[model samples]
Target: MHYSFSKDFFWGAATSATQSEGRVEGDRKGENIWDYASKEYNHRFFDGVTTEQTSRFYEDYQEDIQKMADLSFNSFRTSISWSRLIPDGVGEVNPEAVVFYNQMLDELNAKGIQPFINLYHFDMPMKLQEIGGFENREVIQAYKKYAETCFELFGDKVAYWFTFNEPMIPAEAGYLHDRHYPYVVDFKRAAQVLHHIVLCHCEAIKSFREGGYSGKIGIIMDVIPVYPRSQHPADLYAAEMADLFYTKSLNDVILKGFYPEEIGEILRKYDQLPVVTTADKELLSATKIDLLGINYYRPRRVKARESVPNPEGVFSPEWFYDNYEMPGRRMNTSRGIEIYPKGLYDIAKKIQNEYGNIDWFVSENGIGIQDEEQYLQDDMVQDDYRIEFLEEHLSWLHQAMEEGSNCLGYHMWTFVDCWSWINAFKNRYGFYRMNLETGEKTVKKSGLWFKDVIENQGFDKNN
Candidate 1:
C-alpha cells in the first residue's frame, strides 16, 4: 500500500531554542528559569548536565540549516528564546540576539525550509519568575509587549508564528508535580498559572492581529488522548475528567474561546478556580488561534481513583483519576511510555469533528531511546525500530488525512538530539546522531529512509 501527501507538506522536525542553542549566558542573554535551575539545582539533571551544553545551533546554525535541507525538509519549527531576546523580561531588546535570530531565519529561508517560529517553550525568564511570572497579570502585558517587539524586528522574515508550545506544562510541572523549575506543590497555583498563560497567549494573538502582520499565528499543543481502563461508568467518567482537566482546560479557550462548563464546576467544587475578570472574558472570546500544532507521543490510560484522596489536601487533577499501566500493554521502554499509534488518528478526528476542522499539523512526534550509542554501526545508527515506529504512526495519520482531516504536515520532535532539559542527552531523539565530545554529526539509517519518503512524497509499505 502506498501513502502519499501533497508537495507542500512539511517534512521536517521541531526543536526549541533552549534545548538546541548553547551559550546560555553569553551575548547579554538574560537568565531563564532553566539557566537558574541548572546552576542552583544541578542535582536534578542527568549526569549533572546543564543547559550550557547543547547541539550548538547558536554557533552552527548555518551548517545545521544546510543539514536540514539535506534531509529534504520543506518546513522546520523552532522557538525564539524569550530571555535571550529580552534579557530583563521587558524593555531592552538584546541587539546581539536580534542579529543572530535574523541570520538564522534568513539562512533557513535560503535553504527553502519554511520556518515555523514559536515564542515560548517553557523557558520563562528568571526576572519574570522573581516578579511572580504568570501568576501576575502585569507579566501577561509584558509578554505581549515582548511579542510586539518580535513583530517589529523580524516580522517580515518569518511567516508562521506560534505564541506558546504546551503552555500547561509549566503550570502542571512547576506548581503541581514538582518536576520543572520553581517546583512547588500547590494545585491552586497551577490552575492560576495555567489560566494566566492562556491569557498571555490571547494577548499575543491580539498583538499579531493589531500589527497587521500577513503571517499566521497559533499554538503547539501537547494532546494526550486519554483512555479508560474499562467500560465501567466510573472509569469512563474518569477518562472524561482527565481529558477536560489535562487537555481541554487550556485547549478549549485557545481554540473555542471558552472553558467547558464542567471544568468550572470541577474546579469550583475544590476551590481551585483561577481569577477571571469580565474584561478577560472578552479578550478570550475574541482571540482564537489561526492554526494549531498537535504533539502526540502517547496516550494517558486513566482509571477511577481506587482510594479516596484526602479532602484536607489541596486539589489536583489526580484527585479525580489515577493513571494505571494496564497489564500486557505495549510499551516504548526506551522512553518508558506506551506506544499507541491509533491515538494520532483519534486526535485527528477530534480536530476535524470538534474544532471546526481548523488548520493543523503534527508539530512533534518521535521515539526517544536511552543510550542510543548501542545502535551505532559503521558510523551510523541502524535504527530499524525508529523506521517501524514512524511507519505505524504515519499509517494512521495518512488514514486520517484520507478521511478529510485538515492536517497540513508532519514534523518529528526534533532534528538533533538536543539538550532535553533535565533529561539532558540521556534520550536520543534525532535523525542525525551528534557526538557531544567532538561536535560531529552523522545521519542515521532512519534519516535515509525518511529522505526517500520525502523525495517520493509518499511511502510504500508493501515494498
Candidate 2:
C-alpha cells in the first residue's frame, strides 16, 4: 500500500512526567499521588516493587533526547511535573526544574525535535490532593495558575501545548473505579471530579490565552471508541452511553462549549449534577482549543449485561450504561479492550463531520507487550506484531487525512519502557528496552521500524 501521509507530518513518541521521572518522593519536589500510592501498593507493580528507577528519564533526559533523535523523530511530547515545577502547586517555581526542562527543550530542538509540552498528566501535587484533588473547585484555580506559570516560563521554546493528558481517566479511575490514588468509589464524587477536571482544562486554556501567549493550546484525551454488539438496540444505546461518558463528556465541554444532553440526563437521574457557578459556564464557553490531541488505544465492545442493582449500595452513572462484552470480538492482549483499527478512522470522521474542522494529532497510540526482551533475538526485539499494529492504525489515519481530517502527526504511547501504577513495570509499550537492574537501554526492532516510518513519512508495505 502506498500510504503517504503529509510531507510535514510529525512523528515522535510520548511519555509522562511521573511514570518515567523517578524522583517520586523527593521532599524538594513535593509529594505526588503516585509516590504515596506506589508505597501503599508496592506489591502490585509488575517489577514487584515501586520505589525504583524507571527509564531514568529524569536523570538522563539529555541522552534519551539523543536516542529519540537517533530514532528520526521530528517531534517529542513530554510533561512538566506540577510538583517538580512548583512544589506546593502554587508557590515559587523550582529553579532546578526550570533549568532541567529548559535544557531538555534546548537539546531536543538542537536535534531538530520539536517539543510538545503538556501541563498535567496524572501527577497532581500532594498538597492539592489533601484539599480534595480534582473534587474541589479551588484546584481548578490552582491549575490555571500552574498553566500560566508554564506559559510564562516555557512559552518561548515550545509552540505546541496541551492542557491535560487523559484527564477523564483520573476522574473515573481515581474517583469512580477504585484503581488509582484517592480511590473513592462513589459516583457523586466521580461526577464532581469530572466536572472539576473539565473546568480546570477550560481554565488552563483561558489562562494560556489571557497570559498573552499566542500559541497552539489544546487538551489531550485518551478516547476509546465504543462499538455495539450486533444490531441490538440496547447494545447500541449502551455503546452510545459509554461514548458519552468517556469521550463526549470532555469533547462537548472543549469543542461544543457545553455538556452533552445525555450527561445532564444521567446526572439528573442520579441527582449528582454538580453545582455549577456562573463563572464555570463563562470559563468553559470562553476557552476553545486550537487543536485536539487524541490518544486512541482500542475500542470498547458493549452488549448490555443484565441489570444488577447498584451492588455497592452506592449511586453510579453505570446504571445508565451497563457493561457488556460482545462475543467473538477482536480483543487486545490487555484483555480488557478490543483492537479495532477502524475506530481511528471513525474518530477522525467524527471529529471532522461533527466537531468542526480542527487540527488534531495522534498524541498516543501503541500496544502493550508482556515483555520487551521476550521478542528480542540478537540484540533486537523483532516486534513485527507492533509494526503491523502501527501500520494498520496509520492506514486508517491516512484514509482519514485523505478524506479531510486535519491530522498533523502520530506519536506513540511512549518512547521507552517506563513504570506504571499498580500494574507498574509490567507492560512494555516502548520503542526502546530499559533494564532496571542495570542502567542500560537498547533500541528494539520496533524502534528501528519506527525510525524508517518517521524518515519515510509513512509505511512502505511493499518494502
Candidate 3:
C-alpha cells in the first residue's frame, strides 16, 4: 500500500439511529420529532417516504453488521435513539430497546469491530418538542438525565461516546432555514437553541465524568472551512465573519469551553444572545471533551455582500456575506455541493494550529449520489465516482497527518444506503445500496474496493 496508515487507525463508516434503524413506531418506541414531523408535514420528505421506511436496521442489524465485518471494517460509528432508549425521553427505559442495543454491541464486539456510539443525531422526542425542544432550559436538564441514563446503561460496553452529531444543524436548519422540523425562521430562537444544545453537551460530559466511565467522550461537528472568494479586504473580512458564525461558534465552545467574544458580540448586537448563567459557565469549563469528530463534506466559499442588507430585515448569517461559487470548482451535481477535497486538509491544519492539536477523527465524509441505480452493473453498482471521491479526500487527510495533525481515524458518512432527512432516499451515500422497495442490499463497487483498502491498511495512489 502506497498510503499506509497507522496499525490502529480506525477504518469504518457511520450511521445514525433516525436515518438507519427503521422500526419507528415498533418495540414500544415513542414518536420522535422526525416521526411526527414527517407524518404531519409529509411534503417535506421526498416521495412522502417517512422515517418508518428507513434501512430497517432494527430488524436486520445482525445481517448488516455481518456485512460490515465482511467488508473489513475495524470500527463503526452509530447513534443511539433517544426515544428508543427512553421512550418518553425522560421516564422509564424500554426493555426491548435495551435488548436490541445490547445485542448489537455484543455482535460488533464479537466481530472485533469497535463501536463508537453517539447519543443524539437530530432525533428529538416529540414529548420534548412539545416543551420547546432545546430552546428550553428544562429540556436541557431532561437531556442531562437522558445522558446519565445512557452512561449507566451502556458505558461499559461502549468506550467511545459522542454527545451529539452536528449540533449546529438543529439550530441552523430548524430555526433559521426552516428545513428541519418545528420549522421557524427566527434568529433569536436559533441562538437560544444553539446555546442550550452546548449546555446540554456540557451536562452530558459532566455526567460522564461523575459516573466514572472509563471511555472517551466528545461531540461531532460539521466543519466547513470558509474561504474568501478573493484576496480583497472586504472578501477576507466576510470569510472571517462567516467562519466565526458558521464553524467556530460550536467548535470553540466544545474544544475551548467558551464562546468566542466576537460571536457573543454579534449575538448581542442583534439582541439574540442566549440567556447564560454563571453555573452554565462553570459546567462548560469543567467538562471539556477528550476527543473531537469532524464531519467535512465541503468548504464554504464567501465573498463580500454585493448590496447592503435591509436594516429592517430579521438577523441571519447571510447579512454579512454572500455565498460565492468559484468558477471551475469541482461540483457534486447530484447534491449541489462543491467537491473540494483540500477542505479536509485545511480543517486539520486549523485544528492543529488553533485548537491545541486536540485528538480528533474524520467522523463523517462522503458523497451522496442521486439516481445511483443508473450506475448498476450486473449484481454490483459500479460507483467509481464515489471511490474517486474517497481516494482524493483520504489523500488530503494523509497529508494533514504527515504534518503532525492529531487526526486518529476516518469514517465515511454511512455503511449502507439509508434514508436522509427531507431528501429521504433521493440521494444514495452508502457502500451497500439498498433497494427501497424490497429492502435488499447489494455491495457497490466502492464497498468491494473499500474492503481491500481496509485490509491493506491503505490504498495505492498509483492505481
TM-score for all predictions?
A: 0.98, 0.96, 0.98
Q: What is the lDDT of candidate 2?
A: 0.83
Rank the candidate models, highest lDDT first: 3, 1, 2
lDDT of 2 at 266: 75
In lDDT terms, how accurate is model 3? 0.92
User: What total of clashing residue pairs does each candidate reach?
Assistant: 0, 0, 0
Superior by TM-score: candidate 2 or candidate 3: 3
Residue runs of model 2 more than 4 Å from their true location after superposition: 24-27, 334-336
lDDT on C-alpha atoms for all candidate structures: 0.91, 0.83, 0.92
Q: What is the lDDT of residue 445 in candidate 2?
A: 85
Candidate of highest lDDT: 3
Error of 2 at 28 (Å): 2.6
Question: Model 2, residue 293: what's the lDDT?
Answer: 94
List model 1 lDDT by residue over 343-416, tens digit each.
Answer: 99999999999999999999999999988999898999988988998998899999999999999999997798
Across 73-98, the per-residue lDDT of candidate 3 in tens digits comes to 98999999999888888999999899
